[model samples]
Target: MTSWILGLTGGIGSGKSAAAAHFSTLGVHTVDADHAARWVVEPGRPALAEIARHFGDEVLQADGQLDRAALRARIFQDPAQRHWLEGLLHPLINQELLANLAGAESPYAILVSPLLIESGQHTMTTRVLVIDAPETVQVQRALQRDQVSEAQIQAILQAQASRDERLRHADDVLTNDRDLNWLQTEVERLHRFYLSLRGGRP
Candidate 1:
């Protein structure tokens, strides 16, 4: 709770998870907004109830679990639906993120969120670190990593904060457009930088 907070963000497929993994290896107290978002809407949760009420039972699977893919498709296609879903979830997710941050046990903690900029999660941190990559790279990475097509990926890109906007808000940027080794080196360099900022040696 007394540690510095680092808000780490990037657009979808910008290697946010990979960056988070590197930070984890360095013992950074890390909390993922995506994980928190999913956590807040688990099957028996009140957020799930609200989601079901707004999107209907078809949004749930036969096992009575929220069908994430179906909901993603719906929200991307309907701006109003997406807005409603965000309005219902962001507050709950924030609460979970704050709780996690408060429980962090490190010189600093990293809040990894894809929507850190778009959703104003950066306000909760002392600095913002963005993982940067080209737009085409992002689309290709998403196509390979996720079960979605180009169109769906494009829809997500359209809905997220742009590369420029994200960079504009970044206090630091970790470029992930090259090989994994390069990314790791960059991350380690930043990790040390963060430690130095905290008046410690990594």
Candidate 2:
């Protein structure tokens, strides 16, 4: 049977996780690309060994797991390195994402990825939902949530698709510059809308 997949994405710190979690509360199964990305590079994974071989053991923590922050800094500063890393890991992550999504039993499943549009993952979905917040808000939120420097956050923002570009491709947009109550209400409204698209499944 065909699954109705919703592609959910947004800029870093745009409340995508919170929105997805709320959707979970309503029984929507959500698969996260970030989680898949990490899964592909777990300590025992071939991808992790390849990364260490290419970038040296510096990219690995003493415990043998990927040093995500070190690797993030390395790639963000070099476009060629970033491309190489993406080339290596994107396919693996995609495979895992597809498997998890295919197993979803919900009437409609959500694939949450910060790079959903950029990585072409949206092609797998029936609809694209963008959780949007202003750039300033994004920066502030990221600053509060991560231990990274402002410069590092700026680099990440630069690497991602521009805000307008995401909106241009979005089938639905959830503006997240507001409070949690507003977000929950919007999620419920969209949840109903998505169910209706599936003939209003209970």
Candidate 3:
């Protein structure tokens, strides 16, 4: 039987990781799309070889691993390149994501992706949980956490769906502007709520 899936998403620095981590501690299996994305492009993977073929060897590091930052910069600068890369990678990433989610032992699993809605992965989920914060908060946290330049962060923000769009599609919203304790409380509350939605199935 398919495990119920909760699609978790948020813009950059919106605390999706922290929320998913808390869910993990509660024995919920979680599959992260970003992790799947990386796995598909690992050294020796067919996707990496294709990437090298398309973008040249410079996109690979001395160790033959993908130079992610270089690829990120290039895709962000060129819409055509970004679309081409996504077309190449998204199917592979989705396949891995579904395989992992299908193998989950928990009653429900969380599929966390920054682009859950935009990428149409939400269709696989039984519920959509959106983590949210003000854009200012998101920018400041991203700057401190990732150390990327503001312009790059702004470009990423522009590339993602707007906050309003995410909210419009959300089945649940967790505002993460406060401390971790508050976040934990909300996660716990939502955990119970999700479990209850299963009608007491163990």
Question: Residue 104 error for model 1, in Å?
Answer: 0.9
What are the RMSD figures for all models against the true structure?
2.0, 2.1, 2.0
Tell me how far the alpha carbon of residue 33 in candidate 2 is from the true structure, in angstroms, after superposition.
0.4
Pick the winner on lDDT between candidates 1 and 2: 2
Flag regions of model 3 displaced more than 4 Å.
199-202
Clashing pairs in 2: none
Clash count, one per candidate:
0, 0, 0
Tell how far residue 125 is off in model 1, in angstroms: 0.6
**Residue-wise C-alpha lDDT for candidate 1, range 54-164, written one tens digit per residue:** 889989999888999889889888999999889989989999999989998888899999999888899999989999999899999999998778998888889999889
Error of 2 at 51 (Å): 0.5
Worst 10 residues of 3 by lDDT: 193-202
Better of 1 and 3 by TM-score: 3
- Global lDDT of model 1: 0.89
Q: In candidate 1, which residue ranges exceed 4 Å CA deviation?
A: 199-202
Sort all candidates by lDDT, best to worst. 3, 2, 1
lDDT of 3 by residue, 114-197 (tens): 999888899888889999999999999999999889998999999998999999989899999999989989999999988878
Local accuracy of candidate 2 as per-residue lDDT tens digits, 81-156: 9999999999999999999988889888999999998888988888889999999999999999998889988998
Q: In lDDT terms, which candidate is top?
A: 3
